[model samples]
Target: MADTAAEAEEKFIAEAKTRVSFVRQTGDALSRDTTVTQLVERMITHLRATVDDPDSPVRPQTIDRYENTVAILRGDYAGGKYPTIGDYPLSEVTEDLVHEWLWDVSVIGPSMGAQCRSAMLRAFDLAKDRGVRLWPVNPAKEAKLKRAPRHIARALTVEERERIIGNVTAWQTPRKRTDLLSIVRMLADTGMRPGEALALRWEDVDLTGAKATVTVSGTVVELKGKRADGKGIRRQPFGKSDAAYRTLTLSSEATTRLLERRVSASSYLVFPNDVGGVLSLRNIGTRWRKARGAEFDGVTLYDLRRTVATELDRKYGPAAAAAQLGHTSPAITGRHYIERATVVGDFTDALGTLR
Candidate 1:
């Protein structure tokens, strides 16, 4: 009887061990299902949802920057290309991991690198708040390298501006020529960013008052990848830069040109493509290049805005210019409008009172 009892006890112990092994195997399978890619996707969705919540301190733009960084990581992973982080687990993310990631590979430019670093830092911060024990430190803070200086605003010179305008008129297609000219003139006159100008609809224009306002509250920005609901385009709204959202007055010529362009209106856009869709920045650059025959050295569509700001400063004082240009303060106006000694010298002479 004793021998039989001992044998029974041994068999029971063996069965318990088998059950424990099976449980561990099931847990391992579950863990395998939650990949780094899956974790990142969930984290991004969660972050975006929380961005506008009153409890969240992060701004919308801040969230965008983070989303863009994760997108880059996702691309690298899917393409079998390695970012600085390689195939490390997201749960093991740390400042040291980020540091290695930034300097590890040479796929990104300096500006992009800095942007990615900023985005990652925000993501880690969000993760910490969400009770994720992943990152012990903010890698961006620990990074020793200084990012490149902010791009200097390049405004067209008076001569260059005239050349660009002249070239716009020389286009073979009258409608195309008119559209390009109108866009250039409006930007130069009003100091509005290209995106802001493109976002304008006919309803936004107040020709009767000779003024227009850019309602940055819900301005659309185009994005790539799968559409929301797998249908149509994806666009997002402008963030909380007060200067980015403001009213602008039109020059008499600009108002007249807009009025003239309205005759062919098939759409609400003040500057629409031939198909009557929103004018794209890429198309603008292409047309501008074709019109000028020669690209303006170091100038972009944004330079038109800078040119307007500089012109405003020359016509009025710096403070007045700042207000007209929708700058946050006079200091910003002075910093951007005050060009090199040679450029400022010409403006000074032009604005100088006859003594």
Candidate 2:
């Protein structure tokens, strides 16, 4: 009886081990079967739900950039859709395939390709960290991409600035409006973003003190689904960054312009559309393009801000420019806005000693 009981016990233990092994194999298979598409969707959901900076909510531009990245990955960018490797199971995606795809996508735009690669890198890492390591290695970890081209800011010369101002003024003459001219002058004088300048309300400006000042409180942004056509635009009641919320002492010229506009202002906004509603940034850009035409090729409204930064950096220093531009770091102002050592101190005297 004792021998029979021992034999039965041993058989039961063997069966239990077999069941555990089967369960583990099933789990591994399930994890391996999770497709790239599935992971990307989950990753995007997480991005939409969470905020990295508690002080600042994610901006619409950030969401738009992610959407663009996904569009490229799914082969839905530009127009027609094509079957891509995004549908493949995580375990089946090879590093070489990712490398080649990244290189090919760079043809669209180096920055776009970089953004796509960044998203993929995060997706794969998130999966590997949280779920099972479906693959022995993260495929995106080793994938290489072409370096993006460096874009140096072009600061407008005084002559160019005058010509542009004249061009825009003449362009608006037929329309019998000075809205674009006001905005151009404001942008040139204050170094504020076009969106920030457009979002200004009468209450945000204080012209009563010894020095006039404008509060940088909010900015105009495009929204995805608040209109009948599934697109909306409105002012987000916060600046793009913490540094963006500043009280800027307006220049005398800017203050004078505002005083005049305030007297004739029809709406609460410092700048508004014909319908007394928030102006669409896209429309403003279109109008700007039409007004400037070939006469101001490659010159953009944002360049006016850059011109301010360059002039401020030259006159004072990078810190002043950063403060004016609402940048948190002087490094940012120096790197992107100020021209790179275009006017260095006369080093000839120092080098003369070597001679």
Candidate 3:
């Protein structure tokens, strides 16, 4: 069937090469020593590389959180005394080993354990999708974690809001107290996240008209690495979600506070720290703790935003509140932010008819 001996030889060599390639692939699959850590690292590298892409599935905050979870797995979190299985061979990892790791992390906090479990689940799936076939089954999928208790937010009363605003003992410095008051007021007025309020600049606000408007263009966050200027915390130039970027009408009180601060403002930030940098959330928490003393241990600065959401939901609707809070859906606002009403529609007449 061959045209010549040379042609026949060439066909034979081609078939032989195909068989060799198949054997090599099988051998590699059996002999590969890829570790769980390596797979996670690959996924993390990909995520970090494509995090800025508009089509990237994961958000920037998600990448940061995933990295933090990886730190835990590497025993590098905090003082490196945590649970670790980074060196375990991916093919050898069992469901029991994963369960043990999850339980160990749960000792720190159930919420933290849940977060780690979620990251691991995603990492394993991503790795598998990329043609990494080290594992027969995904160990992360088999792992189980106890459900963490959800924190239900209650709207602060008007009296509580006023007290938080007037608490002078919160900050020893008069300037800090004033800044805290303004920040609290802005959060209460607009239902904006604390980070959004902190990231605000003079350019984001327009007070020329009777009704002042504030643009929600960005948020303050602490990234993994320090920037060229040696600062870890900076404005992220975007909000948590697409809906977060919106323009809101400022209340008269918020407008007044901004105007007063603008007269003496030296920095571009609406709420700069003592060092004129973006006001860190840690500083805000400390001041809030000082102000609350022991009576309001459960109340947080975020509750102010929740309080605004509740008010808006009660006055207008969930849709309106969702818009004010920059939520993509009213369902999220209703389920998480707004407290459930104890009473609803009256069905007494219908019940009586049925009876």
Candidate 4:
């Protein structure tokens, strides 16, 4: 019986050693970059190194997002079967092929389509920087996005705004409802984008000065499913235009509304989530829809921004309005807002004067 037990133990030890050897062999194979697949593998190795480096700002979540995007791109090339990156030639990527790839997925929503294009663009950019002739030209730069149609900006009518605010005030759970109303009022008064509004921290707002400056400094945003993995977030100014980044003087009403909200003294976020983190744009949008009720159509959170801009144009001259809205040129303001009925009102009254 002792000899039989000893034989079984010896067999288990041998099998364990064999398994370890097999694992070691696989690791060794993955480590070498002898072919195109190896080069692709190298990209992942570089990404992982970047993600793991303590000094690097790239978060693990961001790295995961990039990895998933790369996996999708690679999987498409591997005949639907997962293969090592070394299996494919890096030189075969061309602008035409990328265009086709984008078109193939064009049925998806614009936001998602844009994200996929952006991901592929980043990969090609990395390859180009490394002196790899993978793509003839960056497809993202060359690919033509369909022009978005022009639509009239929807601002809340005076009656509608009153009704919505009244309804929100009467809600039993007025926490989110009140917050949305405040946000809408702020947007309508300040002409800030939904992203910019959500990104605002309490420190950024100077209540005494009644001025809010939106600079590209310290604004953290999750780009393409990427999250801030303990690395300090990158701050991007409101917009590229000098006017976009400038400080704006807030109205008394705006200042009053901000002060009314019970925010934590330690909480930096101006518009935080329930847990005092950054508010999700999706949640804000959903809540806004509910607040407006069934009668509201075509009105979006963005429309509050338009409303502010239009009001500014009416109160101030075109140039002043453009400056307030952070537009570099009056041309854009005119094209987007000034020409719209919501901004200019009915021109039919002017026709009678001409007659």
TM-score of each: 0.70, 0.79, 0.79, 0.62
Q: TM-score: which is higher, 1 or 2?
A: 2
Give the 10-residue window scoring lowest on summed lDDT in candidate 3.
23-32
Which residue pairs does candidate 2 place in steric collision?
A: none
lDDT of 3 by residue, 13-130 (tens): 8866754553354332212366666656656666776777978887666777777677876778989867788888766777788888888887777877877787778777765654
Alpha-carbon error at 109 in model 4, in Å?
3.6
Each model's Cα RMSD: 11.7, 8.8, 7.3, 13.9
State candidate 1's TM-score: 0.70
Q: What is the clash count for each candidate, in the order shown?
A: 1, 0, 0, 11
lDDT of each: 0.60, 0.77, 0.78, 0.57
Q: Write the per-residue lDDT of candidate 4 for residues 1-355, one digit (tens) a residue.
A: 2369889899777756754553354353222223433443444555565655656544444454545445545566335443223244455545765666565444333443454565556655555544455445764567644434567655556676677666655542644422666666667677777667777777677765535333322333444433454433333333434556656677777776776653434467776666667666667777777766676655777666666667777788678777776778977876775535535667898888996
Off by over 4 Å in 4: 1-88, 134-136, 147-151, 172-178, 209-228, 231-244, 259-268, 317-319, 327-355
**Candidate 1 on 194-257: residue-level lDDT in tens?**
6666767777677675363434323435544445442222123443356665666666777777
Residue 166 of model 1: what lDDT?
83
Candidate 2 C-alpha lDDT tens digits along 1-355: 2379889899777756754553353333225777776666656655555534554345655665667666655768777332257677877878888878877776556776777777788778767655447667877777776776766988989999988888888788756443788888889989999999989999999999998999989899887666664348887778878898888899898899899989988898999987677888888888788777577887888899999999999899999999998999999888888876567778898899996
Model 3 local distance difference test score: 0.78
